[model samples]
Target: MKSPQDWPEPIVRVQSLSDSGISTIPNKYVKPPIERPSLSNSFNNDINIPTIDFLGLFTSDGNNYANKSIIYEQISEACRNWGFFQVVNHGVPPELMDEAREVWREFFHHPMDVKQTYANTPKTYEGYGSRLGVEKGAILDWSDYYFLHYLPCSLKVHNKWPAFPLSLRKVIEEYSKQVVKFCGRLMKILSSNLGLKEDVLQNAFGGDRDIGACLRVNFYPKCPQPDLTLGLSPHSDPGGMTILLPDQHVAGLQVRRDGHWITVKPASHAFIVNIGDQIQVLSNAIYKSVEHRVIVNSAEERVSLAFFYNPKSDLLIEPVKELVTKQNPPLYPPRTFDEYRLYMRTKGPQGKSQLGESDKSQDEK
Candidate 1:
């Protein structure tokens, strides 16, 4: 699909409104009545996503094997049942996580002109952005974000990353390195969980060197009418999986479960992990990409770092040969990651068709 030269309309930074002290949000940011975050019991639920400890699961020397079997099943269960989980005792240092998140927070709080230098376009979406999709007049989310690539080496341009925070580039470089390493470990776990060789999933993702990994740092500004609009629209991630370092001070991410929306409680010094559509495709639906959205808080602004690990853009991804059987066959047609995401970027990821009619996002009202 060919992309437009630029955004369909002029971009408006959501953080500006929060700073301007507006009592009410712009009409363009309002969601349909059915899509708004409601406080009634019918909409919110008491359920919480699973939290798994990685304390003994993975070590530099080698797997404990004893602890490996236990935590392995926990991750498998979480992927099958909830498509989401929180992981603690992960190898990434706590100090680094805090530093990585704080640097982005400081960048968002900077003056508009400073952040605008890297303003992004619909073509690549590689720098600062305020909205998703180029759909003109689309109702927008109450957030601003910075998107940058990390994998494929060709695309990891240090100059493109924010520089004023001084330490921002260094932190992101180290942060991406650690997170990608963990993702590789998780891929092995997923393969083992599916009774396949440890490298099956990794190989399917174009091997480690050719993988697609990127980061989108979302800054959700406090909104006056939080209930009337969402910080992000409802959708499953289009990539393989997401490793999110959430804002511990404020809770806003919500996962849909049994037709109810459940807010996630951040685990201290932990990373939230969730399955995405690519894995679901590769798993042949043994796991799923859970539909999730972020709600804005009127009392507090929030920032999250979402690291997406995906297959190489041009590699055709399909259900693994092992997962396919005469009983099930291939549920989804083979499609490249490039072909899959083009639909999302143009049609928007708000429960729209991803790869075809077979891969439509859940449209639960």
Candidate 2:
């Protein structure tokens, strides 16, 4: 159990694994100080996460209504059952997605000092770093990531934005706009499926035009002993929804269902969308926010971009009145987005939903 303060700066960046020129795993990276389940035989060949198509939502032909209805049903079922789904025919331009990945790959490959120019501190949580949790003795993930606060553009820290690749900033800005738009559309569809007004979620998020959003760009380099460590621990997301663009060549993302872990296959030119804890609370437990994690591989490096959509910091989140009834009371009390963020930081990633903790506190009172 080493405290974060005592955990010395990582001696080797995972990205350097490719250039180490060593044919074998190093002693330092061989075993994690904390013990975790061995993943050597965890793969299940028969189970896979569902992939949904969004092309029906944007159709202009006379079949638009019929197609939308079918798509809506699929989304509703996926959210209620798995809390995760991959979407194809999503509107994001494929070229833009490729460019975003290229820019980030270049940025991560920069010299150590160059990448450290925008290093993150324990408190700020925005910039390039591998440290994610604040708890002492917490098992660290085997990856490096850069976090950027993209929404409420006025609140962005301009200096923390990387400038090395030069094209990084411009490409990211464009990608953010597209992602935000797609999120709004997806929220509307979810709201309709839940039998609420189409704009219910958008309005709750302070209208479709204004909302808080953030992006986490992750780079998981090849590991010498992949079975002994994890790329990211199992945990549910804390925001409203997350749009993940995963590496096409590597497969690592997995979700827990019925006490079994199922691999999520990445779809070409599509984004994986999953409901977050807030959305489950908002839906009064009708939908779920399931536990999911990433596995590391010995052969290939993986890159993923996750865009988290959230309400304004001060917005109150709770079960919608329409979804609550005498027969079904709100499962969790109202909490502001800022309060939830603080709670998650203090608690760290423990493979549990914070909303469940809120329910327990309320029950005790």
Candidate 3:
């Protein structure tokens, strides 16, 4: 039995595990005794999640007003109840989505050295790596990922970006532009649902040029003991919102609702949208930032692209004034993006949103 120190210096990528041709969970990959569990036993497949159609929202005819109102109501219900929903006709060209996935698949299949050239480090959030938090005895997840900061294009570090698979950069850049626009429009609808001006939420993010966004491409390979390990640890997103493009054929993402773990099935050309911790705080806790996790498959691999929309680093986040009155005071205190990120780095993902943890820590202090 080897300790975590004996593991590879840079940490082994999940793709390497798939390439080894081994059939059993390696000793190093086995989680701590206290953390191990039968993942198969926790699933509840009876509940059906909601899916929203965006095609009607973009129409220019006489029914547009009615369609927009209905769609806004549906989105509000989903956010308040489940904090998750799927959107079809989202306007991101299917061809571009397909090409983006193809390029990423090709990039991940490159030689280990090729991927390692852009390895992530403590100082930078971008690049390729595994086991983000390497604390001793920690239960590491079973996924490898490439992360890049997208919005505020000026903040992008050209050196940290991957230069392989040829078309990887081009496809991602174009896709990012489209997703950001779509997210902005979605924010407007959310703001209107909350009885605020159409641009209230978008404006709070520090205008179009100052907002921040990140793109994370995740790859989860088949695990020998799938029931004993997780593709990702259970946690809630710390940003404002997330637009996720999951593999159409594979399923592993799950959300916890009413103490039951429900699987999120993928729909053709649809993006899974979930409210994040910041959004919950901005809404004064009216909207939930639900806990979700990924389970590994034993026979097939899974991949997903997650776009995290956030506010500017210097922007202070707090409950919107309109949403906070005598009946509903602010649920979370004001905090900057930098402060929130530092808290998440220290606590890691542990089945709860960072905002909740931050509030608890403040109360205790």
Residues 100-134 of candidate 2 have per-residue lDDT tens digits of 98788888888887887777765657888775666
**TM-score to true structure, per model:** 0.95, 0.89, 0.91
Poorest lDDT segment (10 consecutive residues) of candidate 3: 1-10
lDDT of 2 at 344: 63
Clashing pairs in 2: none
For all candidates in order, the CA lDDT equals 0.88, 0.78, 0.79
Local error of candidate 2 at residue 351 (angstroms):
1.3
lDDT of 3 by residue, 15-100 (tens): 78877977877665676554444633355556656899988687688868888888889999998888999999989999998888
Q: Model 2, residue 13: displacement in angstroms?
A: 3.9
Error of 3 at 65 (Å): 1.8
- The TM-score of candidate 2 is 0.89
Clash count (model 2, backbone only): 0
